[model samples]
Target: MKSRISRLASVMFIGAVLAGCSTFGNTFYTASYTSVSDAGYVIPAIPTEKIPPQYRRQIVNYATNEAPGTIIVDTKSKFLYFIMPGGKAMRYGIGVGREGFEWSGTARIAMKREWPTWTPPAAMIRRQPELAKYRNGMSPGLKNPLGARALYLFNKGGDTGYRIHGTPEWWSIGKAMSSGCIRMMNHDIIDLYERAEQGAKVIVQQ
Candidate 1:
């Protein structure tokens, strides 16, 4: 009876080890979070459960000729890659323009703003007269379409009127819904805003 009990305990110990290893492996693929507070609003850390699994930010192996620190936006995959050294990138799910509104090109981030005020373009206001109330500008707040951060994109011609901005609509990620600019989750943008330089190159690929 003692020998039989010893065998059973060994088997149970092996099973527990396997279970612990499985749980540890899962953490590599899971989204990790850290508290982020910005402006007067305290932007909560994004819970993995609240975001689609595929849309969560992750480190990925990427092949690119562009140097480290370049921002490559693969609109087809609805992913934005911030290239890092050694074939790695910090990838974030993004929302791009919808249908005819899609555009592709290379530009540089000319400026960056925190808790940016949003001003609806005259053309945008024309399309939706209801937005006229915000034509002048919308104060920086949670309700603002440009959530906690904005990256102004500019090309040789000058300001392209396109922006890489944060949005409160985290669920819109990995979808095509924007007018023309790229939209990221509020938490993700805050992280990106800190890493990206004002003149970082941005490549938008269809």
Candidate 2:
């Protein structure tokens, strides 16, 4: 009985040591996602408390044929899925284009930018002539429409003039409002920008 007790104590000690090592290593494992803005004097995370609970970011069991790392945007559900290994995905609430401005199809991320500039397209300027001043492109900053980061989309033809971008208007998430771009919370976009490669596949589903 004494020998058994001693062996048990030894096993417990080894378990404790292994647990300690795991804890120590985890301290250095930086979180890939955060709410802090990637630029502009460290903007605070969006006031998620005010945002509806349904629109909050979450991990979900998502069944799909697409491979891991593909990005799928479902306009009807207003959700974006970052496919992960296993039948899971990191899902984020998103704001998509309004009815007339909605787009659908496959595209690749042609480029990425931190604090990208915003230039009102000539077509937009034609409708809102007051925006003509920014036709040359607005400089990147806090007030820029592109927010903290942007993933520019490209198709077979060329630049689609569409993007998966950050927006300061966090409340707009899960709503249809943008002209055509997919907008995420400023904090969420920064996290995505880090994971999404330049040539990553992006599918917009109407």
Tens-digit lDDT track of model 1 for 1-206: 99999999999998875552322234333244445666679776666676766677777789989999999999999999999999988888999999988999999999999999999889899889999999779999888999999999999999999999999887889889989999999878887998899899999999
Clashes of each: 0, 0
Clashing residue pairs in candidate 2 are: none
Q: Write the per-residue lDDT of candidate 2 for residues 55-140, one digit (tens) a residue.
A: 66666789999988999999999999889899987777899999899999999999999999899898899989999989899998
Error of 1 at 164 (Å): 0.6
Return the top candidate by TM-score: 1
lDDT, residue 67, candidate 1: 95
Residue range with the least summed lDDT across 10 consecutive positions in model 1: 21-30
Candidate 1 C-alpha RMSD relative to the actual structure:
8.7
The candidate maximizing lDDT is 1
What is candidate 1's local distance difference test score?
0.86
Give candidates' CA RMSD values in order.
8.7, 7.8
